[model samples]
Target: AEPDPLITETQGFAQSLGDGVDATPYGLPIEYESDVIRRNVEWLTADTISSINFTPIHALDGTITPQGCAFERHHSGAIDMSKDEYRLMVNGLVGTPLVFTYSDLERFPRENHVYFCECAANTGMEWAGAQLNGAQFTHGMIHNMEYSGVPLRTLLEEAGLPDDLDGKWVYVEGHDASSNGRSIPIEKALDDVLVAFKANGEALRKEHGYPVRLVVPGWEGNMWVKWLRRIEITDGPVESREETSKYTDTLADGTSRKWTWVMDAKSVVTSPSPQAPISHGPGPMVITGLAWSGHGAITRVDVSKDGGKTWETARLAKPGEKMALTRFYLDTVWDGSEMLLQSRAMDETGYVQPTKTQLREVRGENSIYHNNCIQTWHVKENGEAENVEVS
Candidate 1:
């Protein structure tokens, strides 16, 4: 083989001394990795303030998403709020309404837990057909993080819950201009919800509800209000505009399905995808993707190369964690033929991810929320991939 000048010759970075420790006081992705970032579709929403962006999952390998580049959805754009100006109110249906300052929250016993929050509309664009061409756009509206905070149950207990808990609800809202409020069942609120102050061991970013936010494990992202402000105990669901007019799923018959809070089992192949297509010639290939279930942990993930005609189980990178993203991979050889790739996730509850056709038969293409249908990526002999659908 001819001498490879690039590697045989000393490169600039190899011989020259690199920057000092202080080069980056606060760390950031190196210049070479700048392309990996959250991206938004310009036509998806009327304005950027109320728009959403997708995580660059195709370029990422691990499960934990860095807060800096994680997908962000804002109803009124990111706000700048200082900890000193933060206050949380616990009122309504409680025995004593109380207001707590940021300092007060810090004094409480804190617990740390990892959870995944997914937008209900993550893959809604594909309901009709293959719309977005990249894995990020199709399935990157989610992120997993370790949160530190006091469990919401502690605060509710401090405020004194009523003796009869049945039919009770907690209507939580944020401090942002939109105030994005949503109701949660008392059982769920008291079970695992957290008034989180920190994510991935640092203060929440302003874009991600700086100072404080509510972490509702295994539920749709809309219910996990950011810039959390108040938790109002109510006799029943307030049937707020968010729940009725927005998040609710419209059926094929035109009837709306309300209270669809949980995100079902879903998975997508990140590599050999439109944005991260195969670059090497026919040989060994590593197929990888993410799988998660709001119902429980993902037990297994199956990959289909011929578009669901045959199935092969992928190896889980780690044992799936409840309500957290699970990374899966399949190591195999490529024969240089056109391939239709797909993945299906099975949660602990035995709910298998459904196909788009199956999903349409049940919910129809009229609805947009909670579209967890299996996705397809058509890979050509040239190693390029594109969003595609197969019967």
Candidate 2:
């Protein structure tokens, strides 16, 4: 079989344009794609205008989201700041208190890594019967991107730590009006936390913390404070409102779970989901989506089309180095009938994501944070999807 020469020539010419004309001084989506925008559930969270913004996961692909499409969740809204005026302060139990301008942060060594930031309250809506009508609300509170930043350890060492600081914790807070705060163990702070300045190879957008943000690899997004301004070493957790009144999980036994930070390994099928229904006909359907964990690398992802009764391992594509987003694909033959699709992830630690029933069995229906249960999406005969609760 011979290839079509004219078609190849046209494709090469298109590539040669090299992302031209449409490229901007500050890049925005093409005007035609304006519809691919952040969407929010008007009454789901808080104020109508100042509430959570969800990513268009249904419209994105290849595991990476352009900075503009990534979701934004702010207690007090995104703060505006100039890079030149930004300052990061290190105080408290350190041997010497110090502050660094944004430029000073650049002077330190830098590294690039890709990771996903997911809100601790991501699946809060599932508390009821598939309240959210679309996948944008069901699975859009997360995004993964490559970040460039100095390791927190670099700045901590530069500030000169106290010899007795071995047991102390670090309280990191944002510069936003709410100052969303959290406590990081000293070991984790020094090990992999990053003071990120750029994401996906460009200066961060204002909504994503223009001057700086924390990249607490593999941790919950709440701990990755945006508009990062202060870091103070303390003897224990700050017990801030975010950790207390919010992020904490409640148990059926009348007690609440606290300090539960690490985001467990999880996966979801993006296509054939509510917002992204199966438009193509039955045969040779491709199922794909993103998977990652704060605990460690994703070791396996299992996909089930006949509900959870039968499971098949998926193939991870271009699974990057450790601690980065891993893309998985499952190719199957569809018979043009209604079906239920679900995915479960197992991390390096041998922990399998529990089913929603199993999760509620342990934590009860009142808790919101850490809902890493297996998710089910029902595909109707016409290919539309609906959020479903599978027993």
Candidate 3:
């Protein structure tokens, strides 16, 4: 008897049966995908214990960011704890203080919504010049997912928000060593905040605030307190160290802007960049990236291959959602010439993403946060790209 050629020719996974069921109870992407991972740039910060890791966004597509490869930023460090040990407390200006355990969080009416959490420092490094080399480093500090949890309003009602809503705010903190507290306007709390326990159909990863985290949609990432523990309704913003010492925007005049919570409209071409070079040379190329606006839905995205000299409206892979990641694609043939690629996102409010020069003309170089300017990638004839600033 002769062997089948298909079976004989096939090798590796294509030839052999995979591991038996339950070989690994919890599944993960195959080992061959090791390069698609969360990577930390050692020189970016001093230590991993109190630093950040870049998400491999260049290797990722679509809106949902996989939990394992999503980036992590720590003031102290990621901690280990169990659901049994988790608890959330609501107090301060509330008429009646209340406390809830992990299970109690499940008792409330829950809703699921997908939103993007982007660190205010996502593009912070690009404030002065094109420093980082990859889209993962420049724009990787973000992840979008479907969160399951009770609305903050429902919990606030349980605590009985006081009659005086005139000048109230909510102070939230995490249980980690860093605490990582932040204040939010009471109105926003009543509007769209969520006490999320799960993300993308699973309980959040420990680095992402595990048992619970605040979902401050349409706002900066700092307000989404992870491993959430306490919420205090206050008469005024706490003006906490997190808010004052950092997270504030600096004006060229040296006057700092406080409480700039909303993340403005922004987008970037993820593929054909430094880490994700154009491996398949010179044929039909599909340029794609992610876009979102804190204010509202992304209405349009424009791509300029000539460094803003000419623009083409890219097709949105799907309709954009409010405060959520929107995927856009520009399918066109590449002639192998060099290109300075850039993307501009337009929100429903008619706000177009500004260029680096436009933003610098207003804010100056002293600011380390909120660098939402359009990002440009210099693509060479060899199909490799590097982060570059277009004048």
Candidate 4:
């Protein structure tokens, strides 16, 4: 039977306003998608005031998440301060201790790069069953955007790092009430770290470290200190509360793991997932989602419609640069029956994402961070999807 072309046209409407009149000083999502919002798991962590918020990954498309909908995870709510009042102090092992006002930071040579930030605890619930029941809850603790900032290497050189300060580490701390701090090896500090101030072409939102934040590309989000204010070159790691009491994952042997900073490659099928089910009938369906890696660019994404029994390489729409999110598409015709959908990402280093079972076998089930396992979504006959565990 022939498909109804008029029905397809009716479902897809034309843009009412032309591009010129549609421009705005501050951009926002289309009105029809207003309900797509950052969500919080009521009982996942602790209190609402200091808890983590999840990004609506299922509700989003493309590689970028608008700054407004970017998930926020803070020990203390965002701190507010004027640009004049903001100062970044550099002390400790430096040859010359110095403090730079926000204006001073702006004067340094700037750089622009896009990177994805994922809370190590993303998909933490899968240690149990398909617990959260939605991609927004299981896989939403992440976001990607192009940031504008001065590289930390530039600032370190500007402060004249001490000639005798060999074997020294550096600690970057935030100004938020919690004052989150993390240490970085000098090698990484000199490589790609940035003191970012802008996300997605505009000033960052209050929740996203407004005036400034630290961006350690290809590293865990815990080290990307928000509301950044100080850079202290030190002789040893600070062993800050964030690293000691939290962020660090506990092992099955009752000991804890430390400095587990790099976020592994991960991928999730956003559509045909809980928040976005198959609403249209069983023909010419586009299965698309996001894939990323903290170690490097995603080299490949394999999609499975039969719960990993068979795999096909999905096409990357706009394969982004290293350390940025990559969009992938898998076009197929659903037979209007039950199906299990999944995706697996392979990073530049040839590291393939592990399954939940594989992850638990190696890292144990006691961890709360860096849970980058394959996700599964079950589609019912009615076209609704639900989270499920295959193994």
Best by lDDT: 1
The lDDT of model 2 is 0.85
Residue by residue across 162-251, what tens digits does model 2's lDDT show? Answer: 788667899999998898889999999999899999999999888887889999987888999999989998988888998899888889
TM-score of each: 0.99, 0.92, 0.96, 0.93
Ranking by lDDT: 1, 3, 4, 2
lDDT of each: 0.94, 0.85, 0.93, 0.88
- Residue-wise C-alpha lDDT for candidate 1, range 331-365, written one tens digit per residue: 99999999999999999999999999999999989
Better of 2 and 4 by lDDT: 4
- Which candidate order results from sorting by TM-score in descending order? 1, 3, 4, 2
Residue 71 displacement in candidate 3 (angstroms): 1.1
lDDT of residue 327 for candidate 4: 91
Using lDDT as the yardstick, the better of models 1 and 2 is 1
Clashing pairs in model 4, backbone N/Cα/C closer than 3 A: 120-370
Error of 4 at 302 (Å): 0.1
Runs in model 1 with CA error above 4 Å?
Answer: none
User: What lDDT tens digits, residue by residue, belong to model 3 across residues 154-254?
Assistant: 99999898998999999999999999999999999999999999999999999998989999998999889989999999999999999999899999999
Instruction: Provide the lDDT at 372 for model 3.
Output: 95
| Candidate that beats the other on TM-score, 1 or 3, i.e. the better one | 1
Q: Ten-residue segment with the worst summed lDDT in candidate 4? A: 10-19
